[model samples]
Target: MSDQKDILKNLKTSSIDRRLSIAKASFLAGTRWATSNATSFFSSEKDKEKKRKQVLREQARYLVSEIGKLKGSIVKIGQMMALYGEHFLPREVTEELNTLNNQTIALDWDSIYPHLKNELGSKILDLEIDPNPIGTASLAQVHRAKRKSDNLDIVLKIQYPGVANAIDSDMNLFKQMLKLTHLLPQTREFDQWFEEVREMMHREVDYHLEAQTTQRFAHYLKDDSRYVVPTVIDDYCSSQVLCMTFESGISVNSPDVLTLSQERRNLIGEAALEIAVNELFVWGEMQTDPNFGNYLVRLAEKSDEQDQIVLLDFGAIRQFDKDLLSVAHDLILAGYDHDLDKMVLAMRGYSFFEQIPANIKPDMAKVFLIATEPFSSLKNNPDIPEGIMDEEDRYDWKLSHLHNRVMQRASKSMASRYFSIPPKEFMFISRKFIGAYTFMTVIDAKTNLRNMITRLN
Candidate 1:
């Protein structure tokens, strides 16, 4: 349990309370910014620019701090913007917003228990519920529970009361706050991304949709021994509470995982990457939030048993359109072939790529080639660092430094106005891959990516 001061007794769910909180914060931030600007008028140009950036950072910090105190959908909105708003939000603002923690102070059981009882009614008696949450996020908290009838271990995801009802008002309030701070660009792209965030917020709170998604993924992966998805307990589920079997495992970055054998680690990494690939090529839907907490590694107790990955949290699943998936597929295939022309041609299917100048296309292609280096044959991709690929063609993910190289290439190629925010769909795909890459890197896993990509092909 958190200190009483740290635990939230209740979220300020009323529209008036939320609006007033945001309005005060925005007004304060905006006033500070205007005052700073006015004061900098007499300074030298260099000092003025320096002071302006400093003031912007201060204002952003103040706004985020205020948002943090709200402890609900608005904070989530800020965090989502931080992840996807790089193209539209000012650097200072996004940098500050990124500091908003996903794991906020848990609502006290006194507050959450009543909501749970109301949602589950007499059915709540079927389980022994833990008052302390095992996990707490902006939208909900999860508690470990056990069915009294058979002592089956399970978990209950309890949504914060009124969070779903407050999404629209909170989103609008956040936008107004951003506008007041003058930190967001008023562009069509910003509006589109904002709506995307709004839709995602709504989806995150929809227990029915999440329940179906969890079941769908569980069904799809039923035959795959390498993964585990929790089975939803329908009798205990409601609009505010989702109940599922509690799959137990250690964290993906746990010391136990780090101590695993090389082959074991490689298998784990391969399974992780294969899921991301399968989501794009086969499933057409993805669990887009790649936060490390979303995954847990269940080690095998028997020598003959394979280790399994416990995939948790199906709230952020994204379904891609067929056309977008086709283009993305082509891009990866083109990268595998190391064909610049093919890569450039694949880029044309997306509007974001069309914005890239002709001369920059080859540079962007090179970045894609670097990104897919592990998926390519040594003969096709000459840029792979020497010794990073073993004789068996397994790519050393830890030694490859792949993300840094791709980022360097992108920075060099897309400098200035030529840089564009990718289509939101692409952003989700890329973020998923990045998450997979980070997982592999953390585990120091080496596997034959060529084989994995070939299987997908």
Candidate 2:
């Protein structure tokens, strides 16, 4: 009933800053509770493995509860935490973080009309805007819209207000809380990574940056008719607002999108890989967020051409530099060669220099093979078997083979030594391929992965 209560009650994740603050508060509060009740949070420390599991669960729950409160950008930051925060978090916690989504809240027409007038300085009817949002994400919600003058239909992404402010506050508070809680050490390098993440989160709330990335992607995807990149409405865009013509298409993840003919799926898959490779190797400016839902499969009713592959959301583009670029190439080559020495060497080049136990190298090799096993089967995708081969030849079989090999030799204890890739830029690049591989695995796509490796080499 009071002003303070009202302010707290109205705490919505409109800006990066506000959500960040909430996330910090959540973490700080949760850590205090967990620490105070450390004895109770766990069932028994006598059983080391059970204790370990309980500790991990307690930590993950603590972080997730805190982050879930921040509605917009803060929620996005939590998702990013899932991706890049592995070194600082327990594996179980990381797995839990992966489930965190920045559920976006939709705005009604009355609110949207005002935003359009304010951003466009014209009436809502003056411009064509989709009544329903085609898609949504943590920081911003999107709507399909158009410019009447150009007769263009495009996607309009609008940022929630107060997100940036929330982020700035939350980050500073989180940094200090992390030190007090010892959840993440106060290492200089990791501190730098946190700062970078904070910067990225702030940039995400600025729709203007997003608009530029969209245009840049359009240029990158030029000459590819199968791909549809949105055109930026700079005149109608601002830091908190991004307006672009909506590309008519359905999400590649929509259950129906998958039911498309094999050729259609393969065509889109290949196109996605092409864009991903070009962005990673050539452009160096990578749109790292593969919100699988971001891509839309345009129906043939619009054109007889292959279904147009539309890439949406450019708020999380990561740029790669010379050294990072070279090392990434080395990584791919190493995998293609199945050269354990080269792979270890490349892993080192990328910073995986943690002390390895005497017998762990072989275990790591097995793990690597399992992780890369499917791709190792064929150099060229075209040579890949169309249907699932017998159990031994199936993709799942290869993964199982690799995991089994790893389990056979790798440290069974969590404390056992393990090989890891040092932190760097291509982490997301690895995910892009991994995600693509999963999709391809389902669709039975066989591509000459060797084709790309050969070119890189």
Best by lDDT: 1
Tens-place lDDT digits, model 2, residues 116-222:
56765754565777656655566666777666877777666766555666777666655654554445655666776788789888777767677778888888778
On the 0 to 100 scale, the lDDT of residue 427 in model 2 is 57
- For each candidate, what is the lDDT? 0.88, 0.61
lDDT of model number 2: 0.61
Residue range 288-399, candidate 1, lDDT tens digits: 8888888999999999999999999899999998988888888888878888898989888677777778887887887788888878777777767899988787889889
Ten-residue stretch with the least lDDT total in model 2: 1-10
The TM-score that candidate 2 achieves is 0.76
Q: Which 10 successive residues of model 1 have the least lDDT summed?
A: 413-422
- Candidate 2 lDDT at 378 equals 40
Off by over 4 Å in 2: 1-66, 107-116, 123-125, 128-132, 174-189, 301-304, 340-421, 442-444
